[model samples]
Target: MADGAGRRVDPDVDLRVPRDRREVAAHPAAVLGAIAAGGVLGALARAGLQAAFPHGPATFAWATFGVNVSGCLLIGVLMAVLRAAGGGPPLARPFLGVGVLGGFTTFSTYAVDVHAALVAGAPATALAYLAATVVGALFAVWAGDTLTGRLLSRGAR
Candidate 1:
């Protein structure tokens, strides 16, 4: 198997369920801890934002939408920077990209919001949100990655 950057990975590492201690060892304690801690912080940020911009079932989920789109953009930026910096600090990806940003993004919550809209008899709203989230997220990722890459290249000149 290969990772996002096309680096070869152990085929077994691709398994959804680790079969033994060897497979489990792929997730080291430090990385897991970082993810957990970052998750807490990210989740708290999401909560605070949501509380600030409260929305109901049929309303636009501005906070969640912003969180997810911003998270994707950051993911793209992080990946580009990491690539440019030759992977950067070892735990940077895990802590920031995977942990913090991963925690910040909430696909499950997005799904729930969509579901709630549909159940609230707001099919149009739900459809709009569904499309908007996907489109916005894609555009954000592209913009962040492309813009950051260009900036980095210019800086190097």
Candidate 2:
């Protein structure tokens, strides 16, 4: 097959690889292993944070909020760097992005925290936490992406 620029393309080749090189597909086991290892570390870190800063249902879930926001920011930065660097090893995204960040950021816990707040007769706190987390995460991602892009572009020049 030929790409839009009229270069020959191998259908079996991993798109992440340059066309001039032989495509080396990552073994499924390796990918899964990376994810699992990263997940363990991420989950442990999150658990430690939660344990260190336990919060009642009626109060703000600062630990979860911090973890989620930082995770979002890290993901944005990681993605930008990966794109700018033309990607990385096949295991990089699976290990760091999906596994680690996915594990570290707890949407399920966020939901539970919100539910607990509501159940504790703190509807206003629940609503506030929900809005803050969503908005803060979005803004953090945007900030990280923008900052990384700018820095990378400057270094390129």
Candidate 3:
């Protein structure tokens, strides 16, 4: 098959799925198990933190905010580390990034916090939190990735 760019595409290859056999094989039980295990650990950690630092309506959901931002940072670190290590194991990204960080970051809770704040007649607080979380998360990811990359390069030197 020829793509729009006139590049020859393999007729047997499914564009939606991974082109690599190893990746395809890795998608079944082992990968799932890794994600499940990582998710369980991440969820537990998030839950523990939330429990320890409970918040109420009209107040900052500091625990959830911290968890999400930290998780994003860790995701960046994990990606940098993986890239430095030539992508590491196949399961690494899925387990650590997708599973662990995905589980750890609570978007639902963040939404609820915003809703609760607004319902409590704290629109300013809600808006502030909403903006802060987004900015904080982006900054965290960028900082983590960049810092880890620099550190790794220094070590290599």
Candidate 4:
């Protein structure tokens, strides 16, 4: 990266652009509405944290991370719960997890959060948070799947 003296920054530096940023981000209004519902919930949750957190420039943003992680965890567990209960069904899985949380916990938001941290020059924290969120979320999903599988199997038995 360039210094205060205006040295050239490396163009090869990694940036977090969504895998299919343009296509995914640019949807028609109705499609956006489905996604937006979850985003509203996530954004509101983030906003409501100001009173409780009341610290850090990005404490509000931590809410988004939490929502993303929690939603992933919940989806894994809930899917199993539904399968075990066999209560017919409700919302489609894609509508809730992919459409909702996917829209809610935006790669764009995470990328911007990271970018903000990076530009503010807290590269260490940004990288650490990035790695933790990505890796931790993956592990959490696996764990959730395992836990749910056990719970469903228990019901089967």
TM-score against native, each model: 0.84, 0.84, 0.83, 0.60
Judge candidate 3 at residue 67 and give its lDDT: 98
> Model 3 misses residue 2 by how many Å?
23
Residues 1-157, candidate 3, lDDT per residue (tens digit)? 1212112132112244242235547467876787788889899999999999998899898999999999989977887786677656777866887678888998999998999999999999899899999999999988998999999989999
Task: Give the worst 10-residue stretch by lDDT in candidate 1.
Answer: 8-17
By TM-score, how accurate is candidate 1? 0.84
Residue 42: error of model 2 in Å?
Answer: 0.7
Q: What are the per-model numbers of colliding residue pairs?
A: 0, 0, 0, 0
RMSD of each: 4.8, 6.1, 6.7, 13.4
What TM-score should be assigned to candidate 2?
A: 0.84
Which of 1 and 2 is ahead in lDDT?
Answer: 2
Tell me the lDDT of candidate 3. Answer: 0.78
How far does residue 25 in candidate 3 sit from its true spot (Å)? 3.8
**Which ranges in model 2 have alpha carbons more than 4 Å from their true place?**
1-26
Candidate 3: RMSD to truth: 6.7
lDDT tens readout by residue for model 1, 1-157: 1223424132112233222123236658876787778888888999999999999999889999999999989887887787677656656766787678888899999999999999999999999999999999999988988999899989999
Report the number of backbone clashes for model 4. 0
Rank the candidate models, highest TM-score first.
Answer: 1, 2, 3, 4
Better of 2 and 4 by TM-score: 2
Q: Which stretches of candidate 4 lie above 4 Å from their native place?
A: 1-39, 50-61, 82-95, 98-100
Scored by lDDT, model 1 comes in at 0.78
